[model samples]
Target: MNRRSLLAIAASAACLLSMGLAHAADQDTLAAIREAKTIRVALEFGRPPWGFKDDKLKMSGSDMEAAELLASDLGVKLEIVEVTGPNRIPFLQTRKADVVLSTFSITPERLKVIDFSAPYASAVQIVGAPKSLPLKSEADLKGKRVGVTRATTGDVELTKKAKDFGVEVVRFDDESTNMTALASGQVDIVIQEPATLTAVAARNPQRQLEPKFIFTQFPVGIGLRKNDPALKSYLDQWVKTHMADGKLNAIYRKYHGTDLPAEIVKPTN
Candidate 1:
């Protein structure tokens, strides 16, 4: 072949190889899950109802059940990776987990960093304070102490409004600590999701903590890396079908001791 023709052919071949490599990289998570026969799901391991270890340290909770169902749907074994509020998205981003089944709420900030499946669940952030606190609004909380789990939706919401309301915000590592501070009067109030507040109320009846106000309602979706369109599509379809077929509600009921509310089944957006 002529030198010019040979050079052109070699360049074309290199371009093709580069495209093939890019496609292969895009499919890494899905291919690895299939080849390994396991889906590594990140779960918030100490949050009751959503995810937590039982007395025997066995994985069992609402989110765990959801992850188990997802693995079953994919015909794969389940590998639960324990992660916390702030770490789940990072785990997905770093590919340490195939997906995060933690109760990850779909927020614009989070959507920028990772993709989400169709929401499988929903929750509302609520204010928890003693009955006598008289905290009916942000204005009522002015100059009062408020506690929230660091990086949670509650924390984000409280922080966003704290400056306007003059509310002093205390951030804790987890939900338990935030609720503990509220119950012990270390903070005058706390903001948390419904499930955590319910569990805390059951344990601390003496605190007389009541839901003072609803801060925000958000849909919970599974977190995945941005490039996993195939994985995201599969999970989105699974969530929609299961939600329509009552499977999702059954799982929700098993954990929350109540039927899945119809509004929650609808998309937040």
Candidate 2:
């Protein structure tokens, strides 16, 4: 064979080996967690009532509670990593976190890049404005400034139809900062999931940002890397198992003042 032919053959063989190694790496990932007795979870502290740190510097909320339980069930200790809107997936890709338990929405486009657990909760996109600002419909946002978290479903959807939605969209790093901007009148309104934004408003009783959430609804799930297919499947079944035992409902009721529907709560386990 010529020199070029020899190099091509070697490159092809290396590519096959790399694919095999990738598979082993996934198994190795699961094995390392199972053996080490620890799992790392990502959280966006800016989203209160789902995940956040308190005055004592201890993490708390529905997501933290669920993560701790998940780790315990997996026979491991919980390791928490703080993440923001921009870094949540990067943290997973870079091996900084095993799962993203933040309020993540699962979409077909995102599924191409990341795997998702069973739908844990449904979060609807909503518009929040000062009571003084009337917003009966999305079209009312025209000529107004709407704040959203960067790269979120709310941002993607609103930005896609910014013209039809009738607003100039201003994306922010996270919800807490976005809400602050809206409350200060820097933005006319904030776009976010209704339940999450409600919890945020409740947490800050004195500082309220009135919201009229616009979209219908979408289910939220935990995010994991696409490379770890088996891990993703395991997480889906894990969530389904929790749902079967009513543990998931109990968790949501404890934090969000509501219970998941039978359709959404069924254990795929």
Candidate 3:
């Protein structure tokens, strides 16, 4: 090429490099974790095999195990924060956590605000039907009462489709109330993610709450702030590497085979 052309190309390259750095520069979420050598992740401590403390008061579960690996890969120590469905996104937005390593799902609407890693697991939606309820099919649920956690996708799905399914919907603020209302016949069924319900059933084996109906299935992913693509990539790569090597499956099997928990493994898309 000519000397003038080479000079122009070099000048353009310098400008582009500066713009890229401005955009990709680590945010506070990653910077703090990098400096401290620990990734602070949000988890739902209420559920076992995810984040609930063990008998010795230690964070124990597949999510906990998974996040621990992720921290190590980033060359950092681990810091965990407890979070729930509603607050998961807000926590990432405010940099409360570097990434929500909890069982967060990827949704189109949510992606407008938070970027998500590639899915790690599928979050299946199912129902807990009491034997007394004659909910043999979707048709039988007509005019019947159903309970779901407030602000959860289960709530959105049931509320939108209830009238057509011949059901009325009631939402509870917490999982305890949702399950309790269903057991008492106040609601015909309670809707929740299959993994969580699996954990619940394991905790209360004395009561058999069969999942009679499954309505929706979606992949679970880590949530990150819009600009935090670096963190998203870190999580995605970690999941991919471990899953391919069978480490993820081994963890799932160990917990799933015991009273500690069972998993509702969602179909990966």
Candidate 4:
């Protein structure tokens, strides 16, 4: 080959090699986790059913169980990284955690910031109030004080409609506080996950809290950084396999007192 042609070929090869390395650097989350031999899973210890601490002060919840299984499947040690509703995505964005399994609802708004695996669990946002409150519809919420955990799906969804419904939105830093507000009558109603509302009712039966209306139903997934195709793909497959084998459902039933929705167990997409 001519000297000029040989020189051109060498330059092109170098450029291609550099490009490949840059791409790999951008998408090495899975590789990095494997190399470190540990997966840091962000979870909300204050959110029950999904995540919380037991009486022994040890982490114990469905999300905790799922995180353990994920690490075991990947053959890595599991490291729990405590996160809250507001900061879960930020933790993933800042690489503070390898993945977030903190009852992260997959919404279009959230999808804009981070990628997610297929739905691993399903949840619903609801408005709950005392049974005698006569809240039969959204219109009945007019002028009512509604409590919600800041940045949670229920908060986001309720806030968007609060103005139209004439609802007074009261935000709390966490689910525990939100529930407290309702039980204490600081808020006339609350928007939260059904499981949380149920928990609150069980603890404060005199409050007579009952679901007023379902705001929205959504699927939850493992939150990952955007552009990490390898990590996203691996988690998607992991969720599918576990769902098919009933392991995921078993965990759901263990905490939820019922099986996961069929659509979530066998998602069409």
Candidate 5:
């Protein structure tokens, strides 16, 4: 080969090598966690059953247990970074947290911005109201004030249907505030998960909150930054192993009072 041609080929190989190294560096989240001996997990503390503080002010819930288990399995210290519904993605994107376990649902819209691990949990979004209010269907929501946590799957779904149903959506920053709006008569209805409704009902028995209708059922996944294949693969295997061993199911049942769906425990694929 001519000297000039040899030099050109060497330059191309160098460029390719640089690009590959940059990509690897960007995706080395799992390795970084291991080296650092710590993993920052983002979770919403205001959402009960999934994540919340107990009477003693200690973090307690299914998501908390899941995060602890993940850190333990990785042999890393767990650092809980509190996040609200609207900021879960931002936390991961900004490097404030390595992963998010905040009852985060896996949706196509979200998949565009960030990647997610295999399904670890599931929840159903529902329209809830006091027993005295007859909200059996979407038709009954006309002219009613519906409260929802901002940027949540329920909020997005409910917002799309709100105008058609003649409903007004009042957005709250977190689940706790949304439930408070319902209990304090600030909103006539709320779109939330069943566990959250049960929590609100317990706190205010006079409210007598009950699910009116289910909006949607979604599988929850661990949120990760895009292009982090190492972290994604580790989490996927973690979920599969836990699901098979019944550890994940036990955590779900402990909080939700029922076993995980058949599909989750025995995934089709």
Candidate 6:
């Protein structure tokens, strides 16, 4: 071969090698977890029924149970990494956690940063307040003070329509904080998932807080880094299998005292 032709071939081979390495990296997540024998699952520790630390400070909830199952399925040790609503996706993107089981909802903005498994759970954002309150619908929220966890679906949705609803939004760092605000009467109402609202009301019956109005439905899923088709596919299949076998329903019932939502169990996309 001529000198120039040999040089060109060498450059092409190097380019191809780099591309192959990049592709391999995309599939490395599952392999890395297997090799490490530890699967780090991120979850929010304050959202009860999904995930939360018990009185003993041990993590226990449906999301935590799901993480435990996933780690066991992979034959790896489970390392629970507590994350907040705002930092969950960042943890996945920074490779700080292999998977996030923090009741993460699949949305267009979130899909841009990370990929999600098939639906694992579903929750509706609702306005929760005392029965004495005049809350009947979105229109009733006018001039009311609403508390929401910052950066959550409830916060995003409420902030978007607060002007129209004529409500004041009080942002908190976590659900517990927001719930406390509502319970202590610092906020007239709280925008949060139905699970948390129910749990909060159960714990503090004196608050008289009840579901006022549903704002939107949030289909929750396990979150992972984008571009990892192998890991994403594995999680999707795992979700499908568990949903079919009723394992997910058992977990849901254990926490929520109800069957898993049918739509979440049979996720369309």
Per-model TM-score on C-alpha atoms:
0.90, 0.87, 0.77, 0.91, 0.93, 0.91
Clashing pairs in 1: none
| Per-residue lDDT of model 6, residues 1-269, tens digit only | 89999999999999999999987885579888998999999999888878888889888999999899999898999998889998998888888999998889888889988899988888778888899988778888888888999989988888889999788988999888999888788886888888888888888899888998888887888999878888999999999999999998899899988887777877665
lDDT of 4: 0.91
Off by over 4 Å in 1: 1-20, 263-269
Candidate 6 lDDT: 0.87
Question: What lDDT score goes with residue 56 in model 1?
Answer: 94
Q: For candidate 2, what is the TM-score? A: 0.87
Q: Give candidate 4 misplaced runs (Cα > 4 Å).
A: 1-20
Per-candidate alpha-carbon RMSD to the true structure: 2.8, 3.1, 6.1, 3.3, 2.3, 2.3
The segments of candidate 2 whose C-alpha lies over 4 angstroms from its true place after superposition are 1-15, 199-209, 267-269
lDDT of each: 0.85, 0.79, 0.71, 0.91, 0.92, 0.87
Model 3 is weakest, by summed lDDT over 10 consecutive residues, at 258-267
Q: Give the per-residue lDDT digits (tens) of candidate 5, residues 116-136.
A: 999998978998999999987
For residue 164, what is the lDDT in candidate 4? 98
Off by over 4 Å in 6: 1-16
Highest lDDT model number: 5
lDDT of 2 by residue, 1-269 (tens): 89999999999999999999887786555677888788989988777667777999788878888888889888898888988988888898888988899878888778887788889876667887666677888777778888898978888888878887567889999887887776566876788766666765666565555676565466789988776766777888888888888887798888777888666886343
lDDT of 3 by residue, 128-241 (tens): 764555555667767777888775677777777887987778878766677666555576577776666666566666556667778776667777888765566667677778
lDDT of 5 at 149: 94
lDDT of 1 at 191: 84
TM for candidate 3 is: 0.77
